[model samples]
Target: MTDSGEKESAESMLAEIEKKITDAFEIFDHEANKTVDVREIGTIVRSLGCCPSEGELHDMLAEIEEEEPTGYIRFEKFLPMMTHVLMERRYKPSPEDQLLRAFEVLDQDKKGCLSQEEITKYMTEEGEPFTQEEMDEFLSAAVDPDRGVVLYKDYVSLMAIEET
Candidate 1:
């Protein structure tokens, strides 16, 4: 496709995203004022199924405050920033299918569960490598002492429930 065509496609996508963000903004902007409390930004983004960490959300808010420090964001000012954020996929949770696939790789015997040792190794040695404390916290929630294994499918389901 020509450069102009690609540009047009990108613009079209941005418009669609802008529409969605505007709708969400209106969900909180009940006065129809085209502005929302800056603090509500996190809730809005999460409602759209994005999972930016608190630090990341703070960074996003910082960029906004650099432009306008009113403790609120107007739609006109918010659209471009939010469009860039969503387009860039700055922060997104791992999809459930990917989580299940990772567990599948560790299951070896297709048991839909992982031995305590297997999970420990993966958490401590894999990409980004969780700290012992982080792994311990996760284990405390996911493991039942008597089982000696994490039923990852059930664990993931619980995570989904907690999210909702």
Candidate 2:
């Protein structure tokens, strides 16, 4: 494509992205105040199909606010932050981080480990529940035989090893 064509394509892509962000803002700005609070920000990020860790979400919010006082983020300000997150998602993928976050969600008690019962509950609630055999296999691979729990570190290491 020519330089002009490339520039036009870039502009079009940006416009489309902006439109999607605007639509999301409208959907999540529940109060119709044209702004989203910190809690709503998490919902918005998840609504976009991104599962950022709690720390990541906090960091993102901090980066968005800078030194400003805690308050709602106007759509105008949120747009750039959302764009940056999307860029980071594209350039620096972190499946490990996502997995850890998922584990954390399952480890509801903040126990640093998931017991067989916990895994079963989560998988069952996830809508195509795991079969008994699949559940047993997953538990065997993920859980520590001695502790009978899937520690966070073990889970992360196992997932990383599998990736390679």
Candidate 3:
């Protein structure tokens, strides 16, 4: 193959690897949002990409922790690893259960569905508000007034679970 072809092959391989890593982390993040522990870190690491020992992950976390400016672990910093590790834990709630829980958390009303106004108000009151356009985009296709209310299952499945 020509030099350019070789370079393209390498780039393609890298892209594939990146996609795998991204998908793994995305799964992990979803599980972590539900809650997982530090002791289970090694398992999550293995599930995320390659298998690494618990001690290794612990050591890496220790180093990462020490180097942190705030002297504490931050969600943004360890999110990838943490999300991946926790995903391997078997106690994860089913998707349906997670959906129900999310609805319960966000619903704030016994109405059984979140309206655009409710979501917008919730985000605003929480301080990390979403823009009108962003909110619409996030809720689009997921919520349906025609259905009488946004189903909890649809809402959870529709929302992007990645670290934003």
Which candidate gets the maximum TM-score versus the true structure?
1
lDDT of 2 by residue, 1-164 (tens): 56898889978977877787789889978899878776688768765556566567778788776366667878877898787676555323346777788888777789899878778888767766666866887787888888987787667855542221
- Best-to-worst ranking by TM-score: 1, 2, 3
lDDT by residue (tens digit), candidate 3, 1-164 = 57998999967865664565455445545455533344344444555443344345566577545353443443455654444444443233345466578669887767777776676677567655556765676667566868644666666654433321
- Superposed model 2: Cα runs more than 4 Å off: 66-70, 90-116, 120-164
Which is the leading candidate under lDDT? Answer: 1
Per-model TM-score on C-alpha atoms: 0.57, 0.54, 0.38
lDDT of 2: 0.73
Question: Each candidate: what lDDT?
Answer: 0.79, 0.73, 0.55
Candidate 1 lDDT over 103-151, as tens digits, reads 8888889987888789999888977566787688889999967887899
- In model 1, how large is the Cα lDDT of residue 117? 87
Better of 1 and 3 by TM-score: 1
Candidate 3 wrongly placed segments (more than 4 Å): 1-15, 19-99, 145-148, 160-164
- Candidate 2 has what TM-score? 0.54
